[model samples]
Target: MAHIMITGGSSGIGLQIARLLVQRGERVSLLARDPAKLEAAKHALQSQYPDSRPVHIQAVDVTDGAALHAAVMDCVASQGAIDTLIASAGMIVPGSFLDQTAGDFNSQIDTNLIGVANAIRAVYPSMIAAGRGTITIISSGAALLGIPGYTAYCASKYGLRGLATALRLEAKPKGVSVCICFPPDTDTPQFRQEIAQRGPETKRFLGPPKPWPVETVAKHIVKGMDAGKGEIFFGFDMMMLDKLGPIIRPILEKAYERRNKKHIGAQEGR
Candidate 1:
């Protein structure tokens, strides 16, 4: 069984991905900031696989490079060299740029973009020395199209796309694979939190796009990693954004602006 380590495996998409991997009997290591959540995740997985599939967990903030590296080393000792690293740990705080604090903005960038980098860096040496491994970066739609009230979110995700592109070239020569998946808004705790913070302009601009269950997204992501895809995108909207976004983004933006005019007017009034 492949050893898959997910940076945000304690909750949301990360935990869901771990669940799927455990069900398939793959060994998993989960890293997150919350010890309680980590323990809960381990229990949930172990209970399901009472036959005792390996499910390891560590509590460490992804923003701390040294601590992250140490946790990776410890997991490597128990789980063997990581066969796959899913950099899925991420955070978001939705608000218009002017209204968002510098701390909030920087926090998202730290966890989403730099955190992903740290996770990859921690495992890359082992993978390169072993002459093989997969790294999957979990980006978002904001990576492709800027969403209203997600200035910071978009900045971080866009950086991930660039990182994935550049890293792909470097990894290919080392017999390692780097893949980035842009998932649409999925039903996750973080996304729900973001929804709660969005202004009406942001909400209206987003419209009523339905969220994919974490189960479906996790399944797709795992399959993509297995297939060694360079990039993975889901659903029709994402497909369009990936294949024809340059042609369509302007049109969509104009439409969104028109739809949310009233919301903007209200914000300006305030």
Candidate 2:
């Protein structure tokens, strides 16, 4: 069985991914900031797959590099060498760029981008020595465009895309495959939180929140990873965005601007 370690594995997409892997009889190690959540996730997985290898849980904030590294090491010690590392830990703050503070940008960068780097750095040596491993990065649709309220979120996810591109070049020669998944809005706690903070312009441009189920996304991601795909784009919208993002950007921007104008006018009238 493959030993897999996932950051942010206590909840949402991460937890769902763990559930799938455990069902497949793969050993899973979950790293997250909340100890209670971690334990709860472990229990849920164990209850589902009682005969599978014990689920490992480590409580550590992804933003804390040292703590993350130590937790990763402990996970490795308990689970043996990590055959796959899924960097799913991420955060987002939705608002106009002017309304968002420097701290908002920094926090997203530190967790979404830098946190992935730290987790990779911690487990890279082991994977390198083994001369084979898979690294799955969970990016978002925001990485494709500069959404008004998701300015900081866009920056962080865009940074992840660049990181994945460069890291793949280095990892391939070492027999490591890096897979990046660009999932559309997923129905998760994080998405709910993002919606609560979205600006009027963002809300208008985005329209209704039609999110894919976390299980569906996890299933696609795991399948793509197993296929050794370089990039995994879910849904027609995401596939189109991946291929035609640059070509259609101007049109999208204009459309969003028009929506923003109407939204701003409505707010003023109210």
lDDT of 2 by residue, 1-270 (tens): 999999999999999999999998998999998999999999999998899889999999888888888998899899899999999999888877788898987899899999999999988988999999999999998888878788888998999999999999999999998999989999999889887877767776778889999999999999999888999998887888889988878888898888778867888999
Per-model TM-score, in order, reads 0.95, 0.96
Query: Who wins the TM-score comparison?
Result: 2
Q: lDDT by residue for model 1 over 43-91, one digit each (tens)?
A: 9999988885779988999999999999999998999889999999999
- True lDDT of residue 247, candidate 1: 92
Q: On a 0 to 100 scale, what is the lDDT of residue 119 in model 2?
A: 91
Q: Candidate 2: where are CA atoms >4 Å away?
A: 264-270
Pairs with backbone N, CA or C atoms under 3 Å apart (clashes), candidate 2? none
For candidate 1, give the lDDT of residue 222.
85
**Backbone clashes, each candidate:** 0, 0
